[model samples]
Target chain A: MKQWFLGIGLITVFFSQTVQAEIVFVTLEKDNALAIVDPIAGKLLKTIDIGQRPRGIILSPDYKYLYIATSDDDTVKIFDAETFVEVGQLPSGEDPETFALNPKGDRLYISNEDDNLVTVIDIPNKTEIAQIKVGVEPEGIAVSTDNKWVISASETTNMIHWIDVATNKIVDNTLVDPRPRAANFTADNEQLWVTSEIAGTLMILDVKTRQITKKIRLDIPGVSADKIQPVGVVIDKQRRWGYVAIGPANRVAVINAQTLELEKFLLVGQRVWNLAFSADQKRLYTTNGRSNDISIIDLENHKVTKSIGVGRFPWGIVSKP
Target chain B: MISRFFMNRFLLKIILVLLLGHTALTYAESIQVIKIAYITQEKKIPAALSNLDAFVQQKGLIGAEIAIVDNNTTGQFTQQSYELKKIIVPVSADVVEIFKQQVGEDISLIVSNLPRTQLMSLVNLDLAKEMLFFDATTTDDELRNKQCQDNILHMLPSRAMRADALAQYMMKKSWNKWFLVMGMMPADQAYAKAIKRAAKRFGIKIVAEKQWTHTYDARRTAQSDVPVFTQGVDYDVLVVADEQGLFGEYFEYRSWIPRPVVGTQGLVPTSWHRTHEQWGAVQIQNRFKAKVGRWMGEQDYGAYLAVRAIGEAAVRTKSRQMKMIKDYLLGSDFALQGYKGNPLSFRAWNGQLRQPVLLAAARSLVAVAPVEGFLHPKTELDTLGFDQSESACNNLNKETLPVKPLLKGTYDSENANSYQQIIQQIINKIKQNF
Candidate 1:
């Protein structure tokens, strides 16, 4: 029985790392276009122009479709991943800024900034099922690994609203910093790390208690507190390291998860926003909006290995095999 | 008869000797020693002084002499102008008295970076006749407005100009519905007001305005508190005027409405950033980082431009004289060479330095100002700050201020310039000024 338990634990760890390493990056450019880049090659393979300000993009769990929220068009455009062709478009809540895909890829939770609502869409049917009202400026959407809960960060309210996936009802809302822009759960789904861009700090919340267990502050004075702005966050499943994008600073901060201490700062390109890692966890790519390029960092070296020029105003990156 | 003859010859010789001595004295007086006094409390001032000294030495200006007095010292150095003395006071007046006392009546020019009040005192000095004051710092509009002095030449960009450039850009985006978020501090209020004025001038509407008491409001982060402020709001963009490090960053992702964020957190207009490599930004960034051992900020870029402006003016006029430099700077064709694009000139209506503003999305350069479509009745440059036709300044000193022909045709008066044009103009101005 002891041998069996040990074998199961080892297999879980191995599979988690494997899944984390083989991720895909779906980036949005300033011109309302999407560029899919392969992490291993450090090259952009396809560029899909979606109409009228495309942002907050996510891929289906099966890696078949890519869904993008177009703010100006007020629709979510779907593309066939392999062929890099548009499949269809569905109406999302107005001004959908960011979103999260369900574990099984059956639903997409979108944070619509203009309407103060979180819209749920059926991935297969390509239709909006329900719209749950939340705090003002809903952004930073994420789904729990178990697919039981959906979380949306309301920037104006400084709160995180948790929704029960099955019932589509508000479960709990917890206060955070001035502007909670991004959030992601730990591998085990025990904790969630949310980035408060305005506060220049990261809030770690207990998944069960829904209370902030730790507030990690960034220390880089001389730059304005506004410049220390934190945006997208990604955590390794083992919870050993957390990578955060400091927007104004245009750098990625690698934090030791256990100690919450900032370990290293890797300089990327201008307006560095989001990240997507390779399947092997050997490479990380960030979209730099201002520089109009993608910064690729070698995870092992913890430095920018190369920068690949992409479309205008690149934001939000995702990687997949 | 022999004694009388010897006495007469001796007297003649003595007279000759006296005449030679008088000639030598006249020659010595002709070679004037231009004495300059430098006053500052900061130790770094001396280091900067050394750089200037090297330049002067290289130029073989042997007749010039510099004397530095630490302003932190007691009144030991206090004195009014003595004969033939020139005083250069750092942004402080405590040392002004010392310069006056040490070099009475001989002061030619007063070089200072002092506040308006301190500068006013020196301007009012009875003994400071023919003394031209070169102001390196003071950005108070009042100095150029009500307190306009013939002797004082302002250098830094006024707050109004900065606000106007940013406002014009926002208006261009058709982002008229402003959610004005200001800090509780007085400076923040002033900045916000400037932005408000610009918005109004450009026909942009301020839909909602709120003052955040950031310090004492610990409950700002409370989930219960979120609904109270943002429950119902209709605004296109959030304009933050927080200079005291208040709620600017805290307002991100916290808005009650779902709209693209702008102003302080979302998209910001600044003078310079490290990632700005557009146009000549890379060269400037590299040179500045090499000199300072760090990346350049807006303030650093502004300071560098101010100094470079003086240099550019000197080169244009082919003289180090202040009047000639001032004239060249006011001339339309006078362009600053380094970081800023094109040549920078002063607005005829106000003495504000006309430069372009940059849109920095954090450390990266999002876009250069004077964005694509902004047109002016005069030149595209007018899109950067207050237009000449609408300017309050009449240029009373136009005779002394040289005017060159406009480089580009005036923008269409009937059609409004695009937001991108306005941004580009601001950016061009920054480059020109820098």
Candidate 2:
């Protein structure tokens, strides 16, 4: 096992230089809409009509088109980034709850929860390249930077299947925690962080060894441990700081990447679900499902500066320049 | 001035180190074995229903064992070893004396799976004053209201909670009329009374009520006598309460009119069912099946929850003292995860557990109750059971029923409006229930 040594003495601090103009897109699962927000002004611009049960949102690498997985309709709807108009749609598998884009941005890997398969689609042709079988109720999908592997987290099986992209086959399955919701790769692509919503813990796996290096337990002193469920994770590459959205605790935990220590927890709205970072990485936006709003966190100041109301049940978020 | 600043900072660091050391030493000294006991009657399978009940042999004891294993997992981290002693008394044995002998002085927490009278006897003892008894089996509402004890905390949903859960869903569907039919047993009659209370509470009408007086064998005469007995009822749904599994299952398709059966029959309200597979329940179900060689039943889940509650309390409070744990268990901060979609907590008013009751069919879950519009000030789960505002148990200790602390500071108009709306909803619910 690879042990992470805490670089406590040599902490490097970075300051936000200038505010970047960015538009934040949030998927409202129940409303079947996406609200566009101006992060710099901390205001919601408008909600655009979308398909049924829209959950995961992402942009192509070139920022030309946006892709959204509409779970109820079982389709990935594509919209023009500049025009904000519906461009086309791709046939996603049954109940496509979440998905991830490859590094080169030509393929999309989506989790079909009902079918227990990951449907890989070719972006240009909008055709499924393969459907690889996995554990039951797969919800989270993450692609490696080098595009050599894709990891899918199964909620029922309580395991993460590492799929070889070249062969479209599960190479190894590693069990982590109960009810894993999402997975993300570190900046250097050497570590994988998977969040377990039910266990309320984050397991960091060493990519090379395929072994969990650390299990970070998020327990706020005064809050109930059962309510502090870790969901979405975003790590800053410049400062090696990780931010985790704790579900019902309504707070974000900041972890020092070097030490893997929970440094601080900043309170936000009720039942915070997912998170996104602005273009310049100076601001972080969190979707609060119960409060029907989004909280803006000033990363440099480590404070929630504002909360802007949006549609009902705001689910996931993404930011594009 | 620079030398003095450095020397003062060094002294402050030394002082902080000394305080930390002192705190660690105190924690180490305070750590002790958290002893728990499971007191219950041996497995009693009725001869009539032995072949029909799949989980007759493996019930409460296996669930308690699973919970002990789960508690020890967390206990290892807190430097507390959890020790459990199982005391199973036979049908002819004296339960009170055996429970007392097994629970000797050291055990401060207990999980009990006794019937109503035996449980009352256990709680009336002087030895129970310092112990926390988790009632894991009985669903009798009287234990929660009329004869409630401060030392006993309920782990299972009460009779009213289950009835209210079914009524809420029925109301959501706008099924306004019900026909009630119950067996001759006392348990069936008690459940029928609970359903009638739910009908009054939810603004629904009980179109007709009757008792099943047939002593004919269910297997021999279910098809012959059920249709004739259920003939002449003009109702939207039929609610049957046959607790001993006599003829409730036969009324689904054998009813004179082809209506749905709800209460204890076709669509049943329960805590844990074999068909429930949501909210990470499949993991626990699989785990229990692997360990016990059968599906987990309602009593088993209750026992599992009892042991887990003790472990969770110990780990969170970082102490094994019974007083601290007892206080925290009833406080606003105690929330346990029982594979439901949300956190399950005990009500301060009656010690009844607040949980989402599942309306399940035999093969799949139909829906969960305390449906969309049934609201509460604190949580939606409060709508299912007896709320604190109008409960019968008023003599509970004030310290145990601490007023829930508000999360945010001063409320704005939006917050105030939502609070008012919640109050109005609760008032309407109370009026309907009464």
Summarize candidate 2's per-residue lDDT along B64-121 as a digit string, tens digits.
8877766654443345677889888987899998987778877778899888889889
Give the alpha-carbon lDDT of every model.
0.63, 0.81
Q: Candidates' interface RMSDs, in order?
A: 22.5, 8.9
Tens-digit per-residue lDDT, A49-108, candidate 1: 777777777777777887877877888888787776888987786766688888988888
| B289: Cα error in model 1, Å | 43
DockQ for all models, in order?
A: 0.01, 0.04
Give the Å error, residue A121, model 2: 28
Per residue, candidate 2 scores C-alpha lDDT tens digits across A214-235 of 9998989877554768888888
Candidate of highest TM-score: 2
Per-model TM against the reference: 0.43, 0.59
Candidate 2: clashing pairs of residues: B201-B432, B201-B433
